[model samples]
Target: MRLTHFRHSCVLVEMSDTRVLFDPGTFSQGFEGLTGLDAIVVTHQHPDHIDPVRIGALVDANPDAQLFADPTTAAARGDRWIAAVPGHDYGIGNLIARAVGGVHAVIHPDMPTIDNTSILLGDEERIGRFYHPGDALFVPDVPVDVLGLPVNAPWCRISETIDFFRAVSPTVAVPIHDELLSPEGAAIYLARLTDMRPDGADLLRWEAEATQEF
Candidate 1:
């Protein structure tokens, strides 16, 4: 599998002869002009996660690609969007995806928790399994070959962030959701991962927009 990180949480996972784009949001933009994607998976409805208007335009541009979203996003987008059902597997082209998680991490006590879904995509032996947990540090129950870790966010602390890696136990960890960080801050977060990642798991170090093969 090949993973390419965009500006923030937006990542393009190329596996099994398929290109799956996750979270093409306001922080990310290159995907809009691309075509022939196998699937576009949105984990939630937050602007940083969904970017409805921009995604809508991308959908219009790439009619052949399938749009999979969590309930809230699917509902708002109407029939065109397919709701990602928890525990249900979706076969789109060469990729098979399973939806995980139900709600976004709460921003604060006063703020209501919003709907969210983390997607695990891969086939029986295709690039192992890759999970992209949108805004939250959701760890899938199954084995993960590559984990899209949210390095920094409002709802997570450095300790909980490390705990997430421990729980999932992915073979390779990749940092995401880092658009808000300065170069120095990102370096600190990367150092934390280096110092505390689970045993035997490799952390891929690549700049944004660079590709890493697993």
Candidate 2:
């Protein structure tokens, strides 16, 4: 599969002719040229993960492309969105996606936690399993081939991020939700994370506007 990282949590996962877009938030750019998208998987309703106006435009443009997200996100988007059922697989072209992770990570005692939906894309054999755990640290029960890892976020810590990576031990880790720091800073942190990987997993540096195949 080929992965195109625009910015932040937006990564277009393309396998052959079928393409699935994740996030497409305010922090993520490079949408002017995006066309023929098969599916858009929104992990949460946070502005950095899903921009309603921007996504509405995209959805309008790509009328055939489906919008899958958590209940909160679906509700926020009204009739245009489809809420994902946890553990239930939905077919998107050649790929099958199962929703996982329900609630968002705790920000603080006073702040309200929102809905977060992490998705796993693959078949039963897990040959091309790709997991994108939106804004939280979600550890899937099965083996993963490609993982979209959040390097930095308000609810994420480096220690927990490292632990999540260690737990999943994916063959390739794709950094996401990282518009808060410069490219240099993100690289430095990822380099350190590479050294600390438990399974010697490859930290694929997803460059903006470039398509990377794995």
Candidate 3:
């Protein structure tokens, strides 16, 4: 599988001859050369997580691509898109996906409308999970190959991120949701990840415009 970090929480995952774009927000870039997107997954309705304008552009570019999102997000699309919920599994071509519930944060208990999810994608032989926690801080029990975790959000403290990393224990933990932070903040957070892991989980940092193959 190939993973490309566009910016902020937006990521493009390519596997099984399919390209799945996750959380194409307003600030995300690097979609100029992308074509034939098989699926688009939106974790929530947050402005930094879902940009209908960009999604419309993507759909216009790839007519066959399907959109999978929660109920609120699907309604925002105003089209006949696929509706997905926690624990639901669906298959598209060679890619199989399972949805898991996630949290928005500890501070926003009143705004539960912003639902979050983690997507697991793979086949029978080898399973690969990409946990896009959206604005969530909860750590799931399931094991994952690659975890796209939010390192710094408005509601998350540095200690909270460390605790999340310790609980999830993913093979490779890539930091996201740190766009508003300074370069020094990111560096410090990365360094903290290096020191906090008890099992020495692989720390992967995604560059704004770079892509990594798993």
Sort order, TM-score high to low: 1, 2, 3
Give the runs in model 2 whose Cα sits over 4 Å from its true position.
Answer: none
**lDDT (10s digit) by residue, model 3, range 13-125:** 88878888888888778764567888888887777777756767777887777788876677767685776787787786678777777545656666544567767776666
lDDT of 1 at 186: 91
lDDT per residue, candidate 2, 1-214, as tens digits? 8888888889888885689999988998987467788898899989888876688788877888888998888887777688986777788888888888888888787999888988998766673478998877878788899998889887877888899999989998988877898879887888878888867688887677678878
Quality of model 2 by C-alpha lDDT: 0.84
Q: What residue pairs are clashing in model 1?
A: none
TM-score of 2: 0.94
Cα lDDT computed for each candidate against the true fold: 0.84, 0.84, 0.76
Q: Which regions of candidate 3 fall more than 4 Å away from where they truly are?
A: 109-113, 126-128
Model 1, 10-74: lDDT tens digits are: 99988879988999988875666878888888999877876767887778777888889998889
Better structure of 2 and 3 per lDDT: 2
Q: For model 1, what is the alpha-carbon lDDT of residue 8? A: 82
What's model 1's overall lDDT?
0.84
Deviation of model 1 at 8, angstroms? 0.8
**Residue ranges of candidate 1 with Cα displaced over 4 Å:** 125-128
TM-score of each: 0.95, 0.94, 0.91
